[model samples]
Target chain A: MDVRVDRDRCIGAGMCALTAPEIFDQDEDEGLVVLLNTRPPQERRAAVRIAAGACPAAVITLTEQDTSTAP
Target chain B: MQHEPSLTEPVTLPTQRAAGCPFDPPAGLAELREQRPLTRMTYPDGHVGWLATGYPAVRAILGDPRFSSRYELLHYPFPGGPEGPLPPAPVGDMTGMDAPEHTRYRRLLMGKFTVRRMRQLTDRVEEITAEHLDALEHRGPGADLVKAFARPIPALVICELLGVPYADRDRFQGHADTIMSMDAPPEEGYAAMAALQEYMAHLVAAKRADPSDDLLGDLACDSDLTDEELIGIGAFLLAAGLDTTANMIAHGTFALLTNPAQAEALRTDPDLAPRAVEELMRYLTVAPTTVRSALEDVEVEGQMIKAGESVTISLEAANRDRERFPDPDVLDLHRKATGHLGFGHGIHQCLGQQLARVELMVALPALLGRFPTLRLDVPADEVPLRTNMNIYGVHRLPVTWDED
Candidate 1:
């Protein structure tokens, strides 16, 4: 799955980081959103979903990959 | 139409529900939640307001940028009263502000409530809870857990957060109580806010002169925040930190006592406490409702909420929605509740959540461990619930335990 964050819409609420800090980090100066993984491996799908769900602005979007196609 | 009622109505305030202030909503609210779900309410002064009781709609309104929190602090045009505007809302604080202004004020105070900073206070919180438990042990038998246990933990934690001397804790508690009281006349509420601000100003001055590791000192040194803003944040934490968790601790204890099965589960396995705490928070939603105004005309679920109309999001209702929580009424310790609006739903979500969680995670287990066999001193129905309280909670919870 790929995770994307619209930084302009981000308010630096930090909920994204709170939900999945492993895959999300915030710029310390402004606390704006940052994604540690542009495309997370299959095993990290749940963390990506949590990050999406916990985003207060609903800015994070996850596009899932069909694991059956993966090597 | 009447205001929409929260979803917990079926269990907490069923049509045949027992009469009391805490457990049951007032007739107007219960009728609204159960029947209308989504409807317009006429404020006492005859103004029209939207009340969204349904889960999806309320959550959307809270998270939607179209809504504003600023108008919440003003005197609204009510449905039927004097021709003049309704008297200004007595309590005005940061929760009522929005956007750049809100963001600025929030930034000044964020670090204090962050998980990183709050972690340092956990050892102190445990020490305080242990001390309370020790006192309860010495004064064992019948004791009001609310006064001795639930209330002190938050009060002390808030004091530490504000850099206030522990000796002043009682004074802050008094102000907090008045601000949260449903029956408090607007005058008393206003007085409480002012008194709290005054106290915070004095504390800020002290912190200015002599800085410390505490949050208040950090805020005091920040040049970005005005005095009013600093005083306001201090006042905000003082009241929020005390009242919200105090109610949660008390109500959660009451919930566990009534649901002995859950209590036993926690007692047998301490690991159950964290999840159990989350369930308690979801099931016994302390805030119950939060009000936000429309920033502009916005449509949700095909309904139009005009700009400036006040809309209330039922946290209690949303958290318990069967769609989100199967068997919404049941207190399942293991329920995988990923999204509950207990703290809130958007950018303005409760910053103090981590601090509240740490307190509960520690307090609940420590509380259970202290008196595993503790049972209510009075019948469950006999305990008084604080009804119409600005926040939902029990008035007093009496429990008795015998030491081995």
Candidate 2:
């Protein structure tokens, strides 16, 4: 899985970071999204997807690769 | 020559919620959203600007920073539009300020309000809710829920978080109420503000002298925020935290009592409190309308809003648009209430939202659990509504419960 966050657009409500801290963290000084893991193992992908979906600003996006989506 | 548009019509803001349906948005808003998604609105000051009831338009406007939140720059939407561009929001009041400035204060405070930190307070919230519920139960079969339960939880929680002495809460809440009141006497309100300022100034100084682990203390220890900024931030949090949540609890209880089926649903399944809270927030948008001014020429949904022109995004209206949420009028506890703008949205979304959510999540379930047969002491019509205030809610929720 791959993830991206728009720092400029992030108002830093902190929902993303709080939900999936492994994948996302915030700049304490700026309260902006710090995309920690651009790509993560399959185990973390599901949680990251939930985090992305839950973001209030819709700043987080994830793309799943073929192997990642493999059943 | 401009062609005449037959479909579009003028509409003024702040139409009244239909009688006996205090939980729903104005009936006219539903009609307006259908007839004219966007309309030419004339403010009381006679400044003609756009008024939006459509969901998409409101989302675009609130999410875009170009639509400045600077209160002074925008044409005020309420009764009397204050003449002249207002002064910038006070040093620490980040709500009315734009980015960079807003970024500074919001960033400093973000450390305190993180979702994890807020969730950690769930146990504390439960304790507080239990304490209030115990007192309410002990009082009698009939009592004012607002004074007995709704008002105390948020007030105490905020005071504890900000390190403001809880002993001073009554004085502090009084001043905060004055500042929030739309119809209060100007001189009286000004005096309350001054008193609150003086009170906060002393508290800030004490924190500076001896900082602690609380939010205000943490800031006082690390940051170089001046006393005024600290006071302003404290005051801002106090006003925001106290009013919105208090009303939600008070009015939310009223809403549930009137709709017993919904209350029973919550009582039977306590887990439903979270979604029920969201539905209540959407159904009763306490912070009715927010104003924004275009910083540059922007085309939104085919309408060109020129720079300096302002628009009012009626959240009450937007949240109820049937296109977005089917049968938006109905309060469904099990409904997927995510993405609702109960806490508003975008960069300027509510800061203390997680805390607010946790409090409501804990308070509502506990209240219902403690008093299964809870109900309104007064008739629905006699239950006073806060129509005059900027925040829509009840003046008092008179409630009763089975003594046995």
Candidate 3:
């Protein structure tokens, strides 16, 4: 899965970081989302999905890719 | 604006919960949600507006920018309330302001309440929670948990964060109470708000003259925000952070007391604290209702909400929506209750949410652990409820524990 976060849209409520600390972190200064792993492995998908869904700002977006078909 | 013949008679907002069911949303609101999730309502000023009760409707209204948060555009939802359009939100009260304006104030404050920052404050929250628990034990056999424990932990934490002297809690807390009290006369609430702003102005000036290492002090030193803005921000943060968390602690305790099985589950397993807090927040939903005005005409759930009309979103009712939460009325600690509107949604979501979570995660479990046999000192029905306040909670939870 591919993950992306929009810092401009983030209100820094920190749901993403709290929900999926491995995939996302808030910048120490502004607390806006900081994407830790843009392409998290399959094991981390559930947490990522929860984090995205739980975000109040809806700042996190995820794209699913077929790993077997990829080069 | 064309209204359907069926929409001629509008339902007034329901304020009273059913007897003996203190934890649930008002029965009338639940019935309304069941019948029509989104319906027209008559405001105090005779303005016809919308009332949203379903979880999806509330979430969609809050998330949509077509709906404005501007205070001036809103029609007061309650009966016999203030008439005409309300005044514009005060300079730093982001709750009543829209983006660009709200964005500036929110951005400056966001960094202070990040997940990492709140985590850093956990040790201090734990210390504060422990200290309050100690006090409760020292004075116990029985005590009003609201005063003796719940109110002080968050009050002190917010004071420390803002560099406000803890000794002055009574002064600011009184002002905050008046501001939050729905029963307070409009003039009195205004006077209390003015007094608080005046106090914050002085604090900001002090912070500007001799900067300290705290939220207000940092803003005073670094930010280019004006004095009025700083004062507004300071008072807003205090009023926002103080009672909301205090009430949550009190109400969560009351809920747990009433539901012994859930309390036991939390007390026995330390790991359940996080999920327990979320469930409690969803169940209790202290800061219940919020209003938003439509900036332009919008269609929601196939209903046309005309421009300039307001919609009162019932966070409490939404949290209890059966579509979103199965057996929504039950307080199940094991339930995964994320995405609840307990702290609300969208850009204007609760700024201090992470901090509130830290305080709750620390305080609630510790309270249950400290007093295993804790239960209400009075009959559950006899405990006073803060029904008249903008935030809902027990006015004073008289709780007791078996002597060790």
Candidate 4:
């Protein structure tokens, strides 16, 4: 899964960091989204999805690969 | 010919909940959500606008930039609210302002309240909670939890965070009570607000002269926020942080006392505290409603919101929406209540949420653990509710515990 965050849109509610700490963190200076990992492992998918959905500003975006086609 | 009810006919916002159902949102709100998530509504000012009742609709309106939070653009939803268009939000009062201005203040404040920073405050929160519990135990057998326990924990924490002396808590708390009370006359509310602002101004000046290790002190020293803005922000934070969490703690305790099984579930399993906090927040959404005005003509949920039309988003109703939360009325601690609108949504979401969460996570379990035999002193139905205020909570949660 590819992960992304829009710092411009991020209001720093920290929902992403709290929900998916492995994949996201808030920048110390401004409390904006800081993408910690661009591609998290498959095991972290559910958490990443939850984080994306939970973001009040809709700052987090995830691109999930179709597992059905994968070996 | 029978006169058919028009879609534009405004429905007054419901204030009365089902009798004896203290935890529920106002009666008719859920039915309104079921019928139409967004509907024409009449404000207390007699301004016809829209009310968003469903989870999805309220969320959409809050997240959409086209919906303005500007105070001047919106109509008051409650009676005795300021007549005519209100003045623009004061400097640093981000709740009533739109972007750019709101953005700048929010950014400056956000770093102070990041998830990590709040987590770091957990130990402190635990200490504060324990201290309050100690006091409550000393004063009880029977006491008003709202006064002795609920109000003090958050007040002291917020004071410590902002570098305000806890010695001044009674003064500020009195001011906050007056300003937030719907029953207070307009002049009294204004006077209370002015006095609080004056107090904050003095504090801000002190911070500027000698920087301290706290939220306001840091901002005063490090940021370009003017004294006026700092004062506004300080006063705003004090008012914001105090009553909301205090109510949640008091009302949440009230909730647990009434629901013995749920209370037992949490009391036995300390690990359930985190989830219990979220569930309680969802179940008893204290800051019940927020308002937004349309910045421009926009389509929302098949309705066209014309420019400047105000919409009141019922956070309480939204959190209880059956489509979003299954068995919405239940107080189950184990439920996944993450996406609830308890702290609100969008750009102006509560900045102090993480801190509030930390406080609740520490305070609730600690209170229960400290007083395992805690129960309501007054009958559940007899407890006075804060129905008149914009924030929903119990006025005085009279509680008792078994004395050693």
Candidate 5:
């Protein structure tokens, strides 16, 4: 699965980090969010999905790879 | 441009739920908006008054100088007042003053609340949130988020911010909650204020004797501020800084968890937290109402508001206004246009907004990242709303995260 964040859409509320710290960190200055990794390894898929769901801005997009599509 | 109060069969104002108190008016304020966008209701003090529920009317009342934020001591409309008897003043006192004087008092302590200053506390906020989450394991099932999580984290932050000893946090946190409650007995509210004031007096004295590198210490060393002013500012900071954010952290979390999609979104994309928190603030609208009084007789939307009439600005109403937001009822975290009165508007807007924002931005994301499987024990609707208070929040939020 791949996750993407529209940086400009971030309002710096930090829900993403609360949701998925492995994927996100707040920039020290300006409080803009940074994506540590857009395409995290396989084991991390669930965490990525949770982070995307918790996003208030709806800016986080989770794209499922073929094998990951089975619910 | 103001619209006339929608003149339909009168429905209750949301604040009326508390037996005619101004605290939680009526629910269909949306209806009132169609009726009279700007209109008067009875004040607890037995005076007729204006209530501004529309987005423009609310913002105008809040940001414009025609209205003042100084009715804190008056006997105008509504319920409680300083007129009955002197209540014990809380941690600080500038909350009762207006503009120039209010501005002057705020300026003395303003140096400490800047975004830059709050950044210094972000790491500590994260640490505190994590520590609390860790402690939840010991709390086991059905721990109250209000007591265990929400109350303590901000209590500690405000304590450390003002240089108060951590051991004294409980007294002040309790006092802060009491003071923030709209339904609190007048005597009880006074006592909370008194407790806070006495607490700040001692802290201020200690700071004077041996100043530290904290906000209280900075105020202590300032030559221009009198001891009285410093004490007043302390009380203001304590009540203003602590209780509001405490409610926000609590309610914001409750808002997210109830909306599983929202919570799930956070779990997957921690980077979206900052924006999510903003959306939470917009949706939760925790600080529901702000009161202001007309400084001068003015006409808005063809309704004449006489000077000194108290006007309540509905933050939730304003945020939900159809004019400012599309699909106002739906939660859209990614909405491009993002100016809401969640923190209030204008000069008297929350001085601690930046600090509160930082705390949420850091704390909320960190919380979800650490507890991936967390889910609420009770249905979201079953969660009790904060009882009869202007500050809306859940009484308790119980959730279980996956063990291991």
Candidate 6:
């Protein structure tokens, strides 16, 4: 899955960083979101999804990977 | 269209918080919530709406996009003879707006409130907290905590944020206080509202002419937001940031004094102050209720709420729901009070929350630490509650401490 934070829309509620700290970190200066790992491992998907859903500014967007031809 | 008064008769809004236990939601409301979470409610304006009193319903309704938040859409339920929704919240007041328009403003202003910025703000908030504590100390034992400390901390923080000239604070803060109040006369409130708008217009213009490092100045030069929009946004933010946090500090202190066990916990751990703030928010539920209109036909829990119908969510009742929190009335600083809607929920949840949280975490503990003997000057019941106003708090919290 592709993950991203729209720095423009991020309110820095820190819900994303708090929920999935490994993949999502907040910038110290502005407190805007910092995406540490865009495609985190599958085991971490639930926390990532919850983080995106919980963002007040709704900045996090996750796009599903097209795996139609996966071996 | 009365529908023959199902289950129980329509209950009014602003039900008195039970006499002795001023913190609890009105006993009548708890009974109503128990009978059925949702029920028909009539507004002062003669409009009938749905009132959601349960935890699940209140929380869900706030987050659900199907509910409209536009100011004019929902009928105000407060006792002041429900008039039109406060003359259409100025152009950029996102609280009255829905998607797209709200999205625009929220996106533009979100960066300024990031947790990183707010935490880094710890130094500034601490400085402000210390200044107020010093003023309180110098003034000695008896002081209206509300006036001397609680109100000024957030008021000054907001003023500095917008770069409002220090000279203009006396005039603007008075106008703002009148405007935010639920008890102010219509004539006075409207006049103050207009004056505040004019003052903000001039301030915004000044920022445009000479942009400074402040939020308003940065917004002036950075965004394509119009002057009027900027003025509206400035007032919106100022009003939002000031009263909410101020009331929390004053009321939270009162709560801690009355519930010394919780205060003692904070005194011992100090680290518990952050969690204590959230617990206080949930326990007090300061901004008790909110209005939203259903944009389309929808069935919530079993009832079919038709389009254009308004719903008043009783946040106080919801926060105190026993299902959500065991012994909901108790003020336990250690309770993991996450998911509480004190800062509200969903798309329109408070934008200034991080700032408010930081202020509470700083002010509450510092005040407690500064004066270990801090206690109320008057009988607990005589603290002069701000029941008439929209924001719930003490009009004047008279408190004193033993001199060292």
For each candidate, what is the lDDT?
Answer: 0.72, 0.81, 0.90, 0.89, 0.68, 0.83
lDDT string for model 2 (B1-404, tens) is 99875665556785677888888777788877887877778776777888988888888888887889897777766774356454567667898988888877877887677666787899888898898887777777889999988888998899889888889887788888887887775456667777888888888999999997788998898887888999989888888888889999998888888888888999999778767877887887798888888999999999888898889889988888888888888887777666667778776889988788888898988888888888888889999989878788999988888898
Q: What is the lDDT of residue B144 in candidate 6?
A: 93
Off by over 4 Å in 4: A66-71, B1-8
All candidates: TM-score of chain A: 0.83, 0.87, 0.90, 0.88, 0.81, 0.89
User: What pairs collide in candidate 6?
Assistant: none
Against the native complex, each candidate's DockQ, computed on alpha carbons, is 0.39, 0.43, 0.86, 0.83, 0.03, 0.33
Q: Candidate 2, B135: how far from true, in Å? A: 1.4
**What local lDDT score does residue A11 receive in model 4, on the 0 to 100 scale?**
94
lDDT of 2: 0.81
Model 5 DockQ reads 0.03
| Regions of candidate 2 where Cα sits further than 4 Å from its true position | A7-9, A17-54, A64-71, B1-6, B185-191
Per-model TM-score versus the true fold: 0.87, 0.92, 0.97, 0.96, 0.77, 0.90
Residue B67's lDDT within candidate 5 is: 75
Q: Write the per-residue lDDT of candidate 5 for residues B1-404, one digit (tens) a residue.
A: 89755553232236543332222324677667765777667655455666778887876666566776654434433355444223232323644556666655555554456445577778899889889988986666556777787777877888788777879777676887787777787678778877877887888888899999887887788547767767767777777766677777777777667566877787788777767777777777778776767778888766778887777677877777777778876666566324577877655656677688878887777777777766778766666777566577777777777677
Instruction: Give the poorly placed runs of model 1, Cα more than 4 Å off.
Output: A6-18, A25-34, A65-71, B1-36, B72-92
Which candidate should be chosen as best, given lDDT against the real structure?
3
Model 3 TM-score (B-chain only) = 0.97
Q: Mark the 10 consecutive residues where model 4 chain B has the least summed lDDT.
A: B83-92
lDDT of 3: 0.90
Q: What is candidate 2's CA lDDT for residue B316? A: 87
Query: Candidate 6 — which residues are off by over 4 angstroms?
Result: A1-12, A18-23, A26-71, B1-9, B84-86
Regions of model 3 farther than 4 Å from truth: A69-71, B1-8
Worst lDDT run of 10 residues, candidate 1 chain B, spans B8-17
By DockQ thresholds, what CAPRI class is model 2? acceptable
